[model samples]
Target: MADSSAPVLLGCDFSSSPSRRKPVVLALGRREGLRVQLTALECFDTLAAFGQWLAQPGDWVGGFDLPFGLPRELVQALGWPEDWLACMQHYRGLGRDQIRAQFAAFCRARPVGGKFAHRATDGPAGSSPSMKWVNPPVAYMLHAGVPLLLDAGAHLPGLHAGDARRVALEAYPGLLAREILARRSYKSDDRAKQTPDRLIARNDVVHALEMGQTRLGLRLKLSHAQRDALVQDASGDSLDAVLCLMQAAWAQQRHAEGDALYGLPQRFDGLEGWIVTA
Candidate 1:
């Protein structure tokens, strides 16, 4: 059995296009009393490389900023492959243009008010509409990401079954960051908004995590060197992964409370568990 007392929390900032310029940023750590200590921060240059890391046997709870599933409506309307694994495989096989054309066709068929069909997790997390192609391109993210998790055989608490040693949860850094910073946008990959103030905001967000002010009630405990490393990464990938790690910590706490399938409550509508945090 894995060490229950020191389960590692992994937070990942993934890239749809995993390359030298846009590699996967991973923050590895564990909770110590009130603090979430940073043990390591690493990068992977390809999805295949990241998948290999995820498949390794270990006790880890991870929050990945990647969509876990496609919108149900899209699945049904596109007449796409049904099995989750097959669906993702088929989707991934298509070129970007083909994927866009199919998605666009589905959108054209849907009514204006219901432009996006949702995944079971969406309602609870208040996540971006899965149909969105830009801004976050989460729909495409689902296409790019979910298959790797499934293939790696990781367990998606509340969604799919696999090895318990590796738990994969969908997380959104924007949600946690916005909760504290509200409307104060920080570090964008877009060069137009990469101002010093944005960098300062990102730093302030990290400081806040270190101080334990977010809803997770978990402070970031980092060595001076680790702190310096996180601060030095201008891309904000390491910091984003740490933020996801905190969210995973919160989900783990909730799991201990008997909500084994943890996620945000869906908005007042009956769509109960739309966003599976754990």
Candidate 2:
């Protein structure tokens, strides 16, 4: 078992251009034995501000819901640097339009079913391609997120190095949620789309977390207001953040048990990061 009081854990629901309409959500918590407490929640209006938060002095292992690298096949095809750091450096220098055009051009010649190349981690993680810039625009999230994490000196397991005490792992809440909900939509950004059924799903998810039903063997302890806030956020950002927090807690537990990659596979591609616990 881990010590009675573990280091702070973080779950970040990132937005490339976070604003009032879509602010970055952060969940802060600590795990003791099997119980993880929901200590607090915060919102950041910009990536820069979130970077500032990352730079703060703290010991934490965070599960950030963003890709930390592009697919190795994609990088090789583009003739970008084979090295992850070099590739990310090159990627950061491009504007969003340039990114889109470049990706589109890459896909233009490929067959329809195989338009986009995938990271080895994608199939299992159910993550969008890091090169994808539309719909969820996760590619941009990677572009916007990783550089800041690098600059803040947060260590990205299997990707980049920084503060060992401030470790950050690639996280996907949907991967965990989907294991239980299985294609059921539990959240919608549109208020009109936030129906009662999704509310029930959210409630069920919360109940599952509190009951220690996931493979993580972790239970959540939330105050009355905190639980209410998680259920009330129909967008599911809060719940997603919590999901990622549980991932962080689970990873920490694995680390404590002597899994150096913090529960990630021993052979995950360094070029394409693995989602925690996936």
Candidate 3:
């Protein structure tokens, strides 16, 4: 366990529309030397509740699974604001159908194989374009999430500055999950698709994290029960949140090591936010 006075760390698995069945998962943890202690996992059953949590004043840093910004190409094609904050404001003003139609028209103009516009960081991060409105509905997520962070006064490292004491960064758990499991499908929202092999894969990923086998070089300290909880959730929400927690820990370490951007590349695009590990 970390010292009682250590600043809190949060990892969020967000949803555009959170529900009792698919609630937004929040993992709370702290770094102790080289180990990240898993302290608690909570679920916000509604988007409003999640925003309410962000609204509370807390000295903390966070890794959020939602995309913070749209692709530069998409934003430019739509004639949205070029500045990150202004773009978010413009984006929040539009409804889902308008956002989707704009993005679809942009895609129609692009080449077939490259239907989606990508961020510079997307090549390495293996994340979907933030403008994607389906599959993961990340575009809607950005519309739902970033505004809440903005409203709560949480600083987004390279994207937006809010509370200096509270920092939020875009995090992609797939970046870390791939390091240990490769192409092994470890999680699925479909109950029938959650097989035993994926179960073992989740266990394997957690074990590797506990042993500090990845580039992050931070071990996960979990009680036996906590370990089970991370491995048993076949949907991977809990595990993804923990992976994001590790990413947040990495960013904090970088900030402490004199990297002012907290692991973000010095030359990242202001309009297309970079993923933490990318």
Highest-scoring model, lDDT: 3
TM-score of each: 0.85, 0.97, 0.98
| Model 2, span 1-278: residue lDDT tens | 43545689999999998998789999999888789988899999988889999888878999999988887878888899988888889999999998899889999989989988888888888888878888789989998998998888888777776778889999999998987788899999998999999999998899899999988899999988999899889999999999999999999989989887899998888887788887
Q: Which residue runs does candidate 1 get wrong by more than 4 Å?
A: 1-5, 81-95, 110-114, 118-126, 262-278
Weakest 10 consecutive residues of candidate 1 by summed lDDT: 266-275
Candidate whose TM-score is highest: 3
Error of 1 at 3 (Å): 7.3
TM-score of 2: 0.97
lDDT of 3 by residue, 1-278 (tens): 48767678889999999999999999999987788888999999898999899888778889999999888887777788899999999889999999999889888988889999988888999999888999989999999999999999998877787787889999999999999988998999999999999999999999999999999999989999999998899999999999999999999888878988989999899889899978
- Show how many residue pairs clash in every candidate, following the order shown: 4, 0, 0
| Candidate 2 global lDDT | 0.89
lDDT of 1 by residue, 1-278 (tens): 22347668889898887888779999888875566777888899988898888877778888889876676567767787656656667777887778778778777877898766776656545578766787778767766777788888888764567887778888888778886688886666767767888777777888889888877777888888887776666677777888898888777666656675644442422211134342
Rank by TM-score, highest first: 3, 2, 1
Q: How many clashing residue pairs, candidate 2? A: 0
Once all C-alphas are superposed, what RMSD does model 2 give against the true structure?
1.5
